[model samples]
Target: MFGPEGPSLRELAVQALSSVEHGYDLLAPKFDRTPFRTSGRVLDAVARALAPLGPFDDGLDLCCGTGAGVRVLAGLCRRAAVGVDFSAGMLDVARHQVRAADGPAIGWVRGDARALPFTAAFDLVVSFGAFGHFLPRELPGLFARVHSVLRPGGRFAFPLPAPAPASDPLFWTLLGFDAVMRVRNALWWPRFVMYYRTFRLGTVSAELARAGFTTELRALPEFGRRADGSPRVRLVVATKPTTQQGS
Candidate 1:
């Protein structure tokens, strides 16, 4: 699903063999051209979903590769929007690619998601298509970092796609992808940690609660529904409570 402007197969092989940071650095230049980039449709849908709850002041885009999520923040946040990631190369492209002349001021920082550099600095935080890099066991610490960066009553929001049913080809596709990743990590160093099946809604909600966020899910109707009337995707909005008793 890569375009001509995307990385070559050889280039992708090199990246897959490298550490996550170095791999992203090598892929950063052509990232937006690849399917790895968060789709504009998804971004627009998220922006629409988040608009009612916001008029937010400052926003942060955690694990913001190429700053696609920052564009959403610029529309919803009034003051400033900052994108943070570990890849300097991605930030470099973001610096040159993402700009808002009249909206919120955009800035980029090189940092890890596990240990963010800010404390209660953001009123809203959003991430897109980056969670697979983190293993299930890491969710607690990662959510805690997001919680620490957000002011009380602030939100950490992201779109969560519904899992494919067993009858669907995508189900097998993702299952196989995760299996390959597991095998590869078992046999390789500097593990490239991308898995499709590990992040489940129940587990994520529990972790967010442990991190002091009251979690809720809003259906994104644009993606329509399954035969069972379940939403195809949802926006997970986890808010840090305003008071000790969870308000």
Candidate 2:
């Protein structure tokens, strides 16, 4: 649907009608060629933001679609970097596409994000452009899963673009796209979940706090600022506290 090398319109329709996991499995081979893959520019910006903060031992890319986030992790982590995703096809492609050039050892695991297999094992966790697959109600459990897998003082980071203003055509474009998705899910079985506007940062920040993260936002100047002087993109830097507190 995106380009000549990308999936066709019919192929995208078939994917959208399938379950989210299965749809990604179908799209895996062409995923990087499609615009659906996170941009290298964003990845480089995130890597720059994170590089100064770490001499991290191990890192994980949650919902690591084709291991794009793993590239950033490889550069920053000293020991190892792991990419975890539910789709075997995606992981297969990731295993082939990502390599450590004198960087950390890289590996891939197949798993669901809501129930990650590890516990307090990673020094850093990062995700790129994978959050919309999760519904808003799932935030608490999802953030808790991230919190549980990270060691004390570890950071969970991802870039979040500011919501488009009402005057912007892209704003309404996303709004209309989400409306169509709502109708699609209502009538379909094995619903595909991807919504651009549903993951609100204010709600997400509060949920991260509830999940025991001390959350903060850092402006990604690479994406530049909005006319209102706020950043067009901000990195959500949610840190697990160094000392444990009573649950």
Candidate 3:
């Protein structure tokens, strides 16, 4: 359901076939217009939730696409903020989109998420809507890399919506989409790994714990409850142990 400003059908086809980095690079210019970019509502809500935990000195936005998540970092962080992504095209748009005074000074870097280039240089690290680019097996390296970049007592936070059950139509929609993705990747080269269903809560929570984090799931009340009364949105706040060794 991309809006009129989102990528065209031909554009989507090209991105789907390319490697994740190249795909994002091709889509970056129009990314903010797509459903892929983090929403302003979600970002503001996360900023509010994060405010209590911070007064952060420096921040990093991991896999920062178009820098929407960096704006949240800017709210809590005082000094400098950085955004890293493999896609240079994404960084270019992020550079132009999110600039404000009384906020953290934003800088962009081109880098892979699985092998971050910095060490213990940040008080906060955040990502939005980019986890799907990583396969389940890749979470260990990716999370470890995020952990490495964070200073003692620093956090790596992101939002995770509660999943729809099998009975729900949305669940089937997502399942079908993921199945299609699997088929496409099986038949193609430069596979795009983005899929919503693969990032389930229990598995992810375990991975976060394995990556040396004390994790918490904070319910987002603003998004309201599901039919079963579970919060529709949640913030996964995973903190690197304050005593973690610095590089």
User: Highest lDDT among the candidates is held by which one?
Assistant: 1
Count of backbone clashes for each model? 0, 0, 0
Model 3: runs farther than 4 Å from truth?
A: 244-247
Local distance difference test scores for all models? 0.94, 0.93, 0.89
- For model 1 the local lDDT of residue 88 reads 91
Over 4 Å off in model 2, which ranges?
Answer: none
| Candidate 3 residue 131 C-alpha distance from true site, Å | 1.0
Worst 10 residues of 3 by lDDT: 238-247
Which lDDT value does model 2 have at 194? 93
Q: List candidate 1 stretches off by more than 4 Å.
A: none
For 1-247, candidate 3 gives per-residue lDDT tens digits of 7888889999999999998889989999998888877888999989999999988999999899898888878878999889999999999999898886877788889999888889789999998888888899998888888888888789999999999878989999989999999999999998988898888889889998998999999998889998998889999999988775573
Q: lDDT for model 2, on a 0 to 1 scale?
A: 0.93
Q: What is the lDDT ranking, best to worst? A: 1, 2, 3
Model 1: weakest 10-residue lDDT segment is 238-247
Give candidate 2's error at residue 25 in angstroms.
0.5
Name the Cα RMSD for model 3: 2.0
Which pairs clash inside model 2? none
In angstroms, how far off is 240's CA in candidate 1? 0.6
What are the per-model C-alpha RMSD values against the true structure?
1.1, 1.3, 2.0
Q: Which candidate, 2 or 3, would have the higher TM-score against the true structure?
A: 2
